[model samples]
Target: SSVMVELVGQMKDNLLLDFGEAKKIIKEVVNVFDHKFFINRKYLKQEDDSHFQIQFEGPKGMFELQVPKNTTYLLEGEATVENLSSEIIKLLAPKMPSNVEAVGVYIYEGYNKGSHIISNISR
Candidate 1:
């Protein structure tokens, strides 16, 4: 198991939706791991609620979910990257809004320096 990994999802457009949706999607992803992962919501009041993030930690590892105004959503941190990365796209793809045009999954091997773009989703 790697010490760190992050699973990220990107949205296509400027989405004005409820935070609940993001949280729900994240919870679903975490549930599949069958590991104890904790989530903390942050960046609520920054830039007119345009920036939102969720930090996750557990026995497997730790990762963060970041949603900014320009970008849809990004999940990154330290964990077993491969399984989590693919699962994120598989699970979140159906539920995303139409405005969310594309979603990509990247797996960072070893340290942050050793990484590659695994796949791209074009909507």
Candidate 2:
């Protein structure tokens, strides 16, 4: 009877150890999966050779983002933008003065070559 009691105690400890290790492995796997989804483009776009190629590259301001003509980006979906560099402000200030308040985002796009640029200003 005493032997059986000791055996049960040992089995409980073994189960606890196994469960702890399993939990640790699961947590690590979950973290890796999240990183791939969130910051990395691992699953964001369709997998193609073009997908792997660079799309847009520029300094943080006055960027020319290619978009389908007349497409609108939702106000809620705006991505983060840092303080506009002085170079960017110099180009913009001449057009829209005073009203270009701090912490505002202005999105502008041109359709065809030499077409008038339509801008959406948000604050």
Candidate 3:
């Protein structure tokens, strides 16, 4: 099993139509992970038009992704930060808006970490 890792990142402001759009996109990605992963929408919460949080669980372990209307996102899960970050970017790229240029992700794991730039999404 992999150690738990947290990934924090951001997108351009107003990158999503609304919290619903964010949830839908997330659900799509989660579903792609197969039946082992399921979102717990009951925990869904929104502080305002610009912020939202979604939680889910899977074989990898509990996962949480937060989108703060400002387009900032935080994702925590059980996996190597780099591997998890890349997997997310790869899955999300095809679903993102055509205008999205890139997403910057910073990883954290027991005080050891690094950053990644998932660019050329439109490509």
Candidate 4:
């Protein structure tokens, strides 16, 4: 979910010195995630001038959580990668409804191994 999205943003930020480099950095990071997470920009129906955007799964891995689509801010500091994943699981586990859907798991590989753990809701 947001974990990947935020992580992608972080990757983009860490490698990019300015907006001009965002695209390159984003593509590089997405490749590591195997193109699972992607940037999304959506119009917010609640506010005409607002928008709800995110970088969630695109193809590689799918989400299995049942969190209601709400803008919840996740922490990004002082927590180990595994701990962060645990935190996200804790927050989302209770919300997971028993049904036909894939379960959540951290995408591992390269530096993306455990640093940017993430989850998402699926249809």
State, as a TM-score between 0 and 1, how close model 2 is to the true structure.
Answer: 0.20
lDDT of 3 by residue, 1-123 (tens): 122212223445744334576567756764454323322336455556766676667699997776554443333434345655566667766666655556444444544455454545656
TM-score, candidate number 4: 0.26
Off by over 4 Å in 2: 1-17, 38-51, 54-123
Minimum summed lDDT over a 10-residue window in model 1 is located at 38-47
Per-residue lDDT of 1-123 in model 1, one digit per residue for the tens?
A: 222222344534554334677667656764554443422223222334655555556588886555554443332433345545655666666666655544455544545633332344456
lDDT of 4 by residue, 1-123 (tens): 223322222223345235444345444533433312222223212322233333344387643332223332223433244544545544443333333122243634355345444444453
Clashes of each: 5, 0, 1, 2
> Can you write out model 2's per-residue Cα lDDT over 37-97, one digit (the tens) per residue?
1112221323343223113334874333332212222112212221112222333333332
TM-score per candidate: 0.38, 0.20, 0.39, 0.26
The C-alpha stretches of model 4 lying farther than 4 A from their native spots are: 1-78, 100-102, 107-112, 115-123
Q: Arrange candidates, best TM-score first.
A: 3, 1, 4, 2
Q: Candidate 3: where is the Cα deviation over 4 Å?
A: 1-16, 30-79, 110-115
Q: How far in Å is the alpha carbon of 67 misplaced in model 4?
A: 28
Residue 37 lDDT in candidate 1:
41
> What TM-score does candidate 1 reach?
0.38
Cα-based lDDT for every prediction = 0.48, 0.26, 0.51, 0.37
